[model samples]
Each structure stands twice: as C-alpha cells, then as structure tokens.
Target: MVDVFFNTWDNNRINNSRPIDTNDPTYVIVHGYQSTGGNPGNNFTPQAWMSEMAQNIRDLEGNDANILVVDWQDGANTLNYFAAADRVDEVGVEVADYLLGQGVNPANTTLIGHSLGAHIMGEAGEELRERRGEVDRLIGLDPAGPEFEGGWFSRPNSTDYRLDPSDADRVVAFHTSSTLGYDDPLADLDLYINWDDLLQPGASTFVGNHGYAHTLYNDLLDGFGFAQSNGTTLSLSTINGNTAGSVFVDTFTV
Candidate 1:
C-alpha cells in the first residue's frame, strides 16, 4: 500500500476550484537538515517548498503535476545516520507506489533532492529501480552532508545507484556552490550540470547557504519539462583550500 500525504483534488475547496488530473508526472522534493535547536532553519519547510514548486510548474507547464513533499522528523535529529538512510528508501518506495496508484507511469516521474535530501533520493531511486523498475530521473541538487564524506554517517559510492556507469540515461546531478565541501560530491555523478555555468553574469551569491533559490528552482522547473528556458550559466572559479578541485558546467546528452 502507498502512503499519500497530499492530493490536489482531495478536498472539495481545492477540487471545486480547479479539477486536477492525477495522471500527470509527479515530482517529489525532499528537504535538508534543521538547525541546532530542532527548529526548521532559515524558515525552510519541505511542504511549503514543494507547494511552491508545484504551483510554479502548473503556471509554467499548464499541466497539473503532482508535487509531494516528504517530511521525516526522526531523520532530522542529529546522530541518527543509519535511521535517516533507511527512511530515504522507505519514502522513495512510498512515493513510487503512490504514483503508480495514480496511474502515472513510473517512467514519467522525477525525484529531486537537496543536501541530505539528495542522499535520500539516491537510496530511494536505487530501491525504485531495483524493485519497481520505475523512477526515470533522479536529480541531485548539491547533495552534501557527512554521509557523502568519510564519516560514521558516510554513504559509500556503492549505495548511490544513480551514479552507476551502466545506467547513464536516468541520472543527472547539478552542483552549485561557492563553498567547497558542500558541493564536491557532484563531481562523481554520471551526468553533472554545474550551476557555475548556468548563472547570469555578476549573479554571485545565491540566496541561502544551502536552500532553494529562484535561479536553482527555475533550472529545475525547466529541466522537468515545464519551462522552455531557465536561468543562465555563469563561469565558476576555484578557490584554494577547498574540497572542490575544478568547477565547470558541462551538459550530458543521453
């Protein structure tokens, strides 16, 4: 059975206003870590962000795509790396089952994750590929955390199914960060789309330290088959003493 957190036409108020088709491709966005006091940092809420993305897609695509926001409170706390990793796979399966139930072909769905959310998407995508043979695309938006690095929370490259050399057609990762260690893992991805090449000239600092911005979200919206054109690609510079070795934007057509 699939666990569904939200449906667009479920409520009479929303359904009566606009009847949405459930057959559209679904996009799931997962959020990253919270701050020290167990509060959602930077006012970042997974559901809110997902809703915004959904609205943007509908406005741009004219198709009512289902956008699901996954929230795992237990995984948010510190020192629970194993549990967090497990939750990612669980959420992925749940989302996949939900999409299947809605009559949306698994091949049409896309999963997008940011920061630790990227790790979740990786695990989830692997599970979906192995079990359901669904989930056509998995986009990693600056997937950074202790798990990607060498630590007790580390997730080895072997666990990232999307990075497999043989399955090159389905996976794409975008790295956009001025901070070195934050976006270094993007280098190992199969199809890497660097934001350093996608930003407009003189548009240096992105809004948050590690959160979605207009530029990043616009790129995602465009990539997911909504908008015709998104943001620009700017040149990235390499700073010394950082984990990022070289920064360049290259598109992979598969």
Candidate 2:
C-alpha cells in the first residue's frame, strides 16, 4: 500500500486539511534492510529524510504529488539477509504492479530506494517495462552489496535479478559505503561520495556510511553552496570492471 505522508498529516497518508492531486509527478521511496521497532540502523523507521522529504520535493517543484512510501516492514524485519533479500524481489514486482494498476504515467515516475530498496527499484523498473514501459529514473542510494556480489542471488551480466542497466531508462547509484555498498557501477550514472567509503563523518560503524547516503541526498535537494559543484565527470566503462574501484566523483547534487 502507498503510505502517503504529508506535512499536514501524521504518518497515516491521509489529511482532511488539504487536497493532493494524484496527477502530480510521483516519487515512490522504499526503505532498505531493517528490523522492526526502532533498532537504530537495523530499522527502516523514518530517518532524517522521512520527516521532510515529500513536502520538500513538492515545494521545490511547486506541485502537489502523490508521494508513496512502500513499507515492507514485515518482510524486512528479519536479520537474515538472505530472507530479506529474497523478499525484496517480491516487493519490487508488487510495487510495480501496483503503480501500473493505478494507471500512473511511467514517464513521470521516479523510484527512490536505499540499500536493498535500491535493488528493489531495479526489479520494479524491469517489471514495469515488461508490463508497461520504462520509468523516468531509478535512484539507488547506496545499494547493499553483501548478498548481491555476483553470487547465488545476483550476477552482473546474467538473468539474476540484481539491480542492472536494463531496469530503468536512467539508473543512478550513489556509492557512499564502499565495503557495504555495490562497488561495481550498477547504473547509467554511478556517483561515489567522499572517496568512496572512507567513512562519513560521525560514523560509529560501517552502517553509518550507508546511512549518510540519505543525509547527502536530502541536503543536496535542500540546496547548498556546493550544489553546483564543478568536478571531473568520468565514464565507468573506461575504468574496466571497476578494478580501480572508487571513481572519486563528486556527490550528486539536485
């Protein structure tokens, strides 16, 4: 279900105070690997971005959007990475089917996901195209790498259901956590932040690096002086199999 949350409404996704147009550009955000009930990094509970993300995007674009937050809490509540990772495939297809059933325009759709959620969007996009068409974008915020390293579950150039180029028209991956985040360029645009997992400031653990992807995305969208940073833009294909790793590109800015 699309748990629509707005500034006027409590996390319930319904508010009698205002009218939200369904025709607006939609942003469907899915949270990644988590355990239930405020377990800090292991939980998908509302982070700093959740509090103001929808409203902020709406205000920035000057449009009333149908911001759908897919809560796969039940599926993601396990510490078993394999189980949760398997569930991601199901959730991804289900979400894509939901959007199609609602008749949402694929051209205006943008799927934003973090970690496993990021790979979920890839699956969603691929399914959407098979059933409908390609989406505008699939933004991967530090996609998880543990169970997806070309192993039993995911393979780069095969039929495995890991996040790949075929998933969306424009797939963008933000690599903030090197060890945990996907080291390979899994999108049309792969953005490496802070030298690719050198450890984000104030990070007590490796998970902090993953969490910072959300922080960076939110801050960039909110606008800062470095939003228009000019840096060297290089192609991932030129790197050849990512043997070099850490492209050292500037963090993506909105």
Candidate 3:
C-alpha cells in the first residue's frame, strides 16, 4: 500500500488516526491520470484538492460522514496510458479490501471517481460486489473515453472496465467532456451539461470541460441547490451562462 494514498475528512491522513467510521457514510474519491495534482493559480496539490473536496462533502453531510481520497499517483504518473490503466485494477481491489477490513459497510459508502479513477471505482465496486454481493452507489465524473470506450473505432478491454450502471445501486454521471469522455449513458442518471459545441469558458481544450464536473458536483455539495431539468432532459451549454431556471427538473430542496 506504499504507492496508494487514502485520506479522510475527519482525519486527513487516516494512516495516522483511528479506524474509519463505519457508522457514518463514507466517500471515496479517485483522481484521474491526467492530473499534476497541482493546478495553475490554484496551486492545488492532489492532497490539497482532496482535502478541499472532503470539506465540501462534509458540509453536504452536515459534518457527519467520512470523506476519503484514494490516490494512486505512482502508477498514474506513467507515460503510457495502458500501463497506467492496468495499475488501477490492483488499486481498486486494495481500496475495497481496506474498507471491508475496516468493517465499513459497502451500503454506507459512496464512491466518487473522476476520469480514469471513475473506472477504478467501478473495478473496486465490482470487487466488493463479487465478495459482499453489492455496493451502495457510484458517481462517475466524466469518465475517460479515448482508449476505454468500446466501439468499432477502438477496441476496449470491456465496456465494464469503466464505470457502468451495474457497479452499484445508484450511478450518477455528468458527461462534461463528451468528445473525450464516455458518450454512452453509463449512469443511472446520465447528465450532460451543454452537450452542444463542447465549448467550456475555462479553456478551448477538453480538460477545461472535464474539470468542471468536479466544480459542479462541489457546488451541489456546497448546497447551491443545483436544479435538474423538470420532466424534460436539459441541454445546458454553459453551467454559469445558462439561466433557464425553468429547466430545473429537480434540486436538493432545502
């Protein structure tokens, strides 16, 4: 486990503190392979990024749950995408093993994985399901698509290699980077924020839009009461630019 890093909100470094709290809900966050763990202007180290997200999630849970960050940076740093992708499976199994060893129930866990990490969580969830029979929920934040999507264009190891609806009881996904991300409806709730043009204000590249999934989810955690389309599906182009409050399908009501 030397190469893997797991942190929680109550105890930022779980390795140094008490066992994970099985009584409270658990959140596991996995970052993608395309990260420096550091961002410009923000200077966000991977740990720093997870810490902030943990705090936000804590707020969402009214400061009563466990937020864990699953980091596999050593393997993720590989130059070859295939090599990096192969490493996640072991990590997923290890993460699942740790939770079960800690006596944490999978039904109380919420796995949130981003990009490549999303698929990693799927693997972890699958591992848990195989042994424990089920996992609670999985949220894929713009799962990686380039080399993972199964189709005639590129051969995939398995469609289930990435996040899929079968991994957990509930799967919610936001396809912010449709062009470079999984285009299929892989989540129980597949959300597409502004599917057309794929022009995100932050940048012209796919990453600009990819990063916003975290931002939007963070906002939901922060109690922004993000609205879901009403009955009809939404076609939002820019999260901020759009003011069609009428399209709100649902919101975490206060």
In terms of TM-score, which candidate is strongest? Answer: 3
Q: Candidate 3: where is the Cα deviation over 4 Å?
A: 11-15, 36-49, 151-153, 226-254
Runs of candidate 1 with Cα error greater than 4 angstroms are 1-22, 35-48, 77-86, 101-103, 151-157, 160-168, 177-207, 212-215, 219-254
Q: By TM-score, rank the candidates, best first.
A: 3, 2, 1
Write candidate 1's Cα lDDT for 77-122 as tens digits.
5576545544555655565555555565556666666656666666
Show the lowest summed lDDT stretch of 10 residues, model 3.
244-253
Error of 2 at 61 (Å): 2.4
> In order, how many clashes per candidate?
7, 1, 5
Winning model by lDDT: 3
Candidate 2 — which residues are off by over 4 angstroms?
1-22, 35-45, 151-160, 225-247, 250-254
Looking at model 3, residue 151 earns an lDDT score of 69
Candidate 2: Cα lDDT at 215: 73
Model 2 TM-score relative to the real fold: 0.77
Return the lDDT, model 3, position 121: 90
Better of 1 and 3 by lDDT: 3
TM-score to native of every candidate shown: 0.59, 0.77, 0.80
Q: Give the TM-score of candidate 1.
A: 0.59
Global lDDT of each candidate: 0.47, 0.67, 0.68
Lowest summed lDDT across 10 adjacent residues in model 2 is found at 1-10
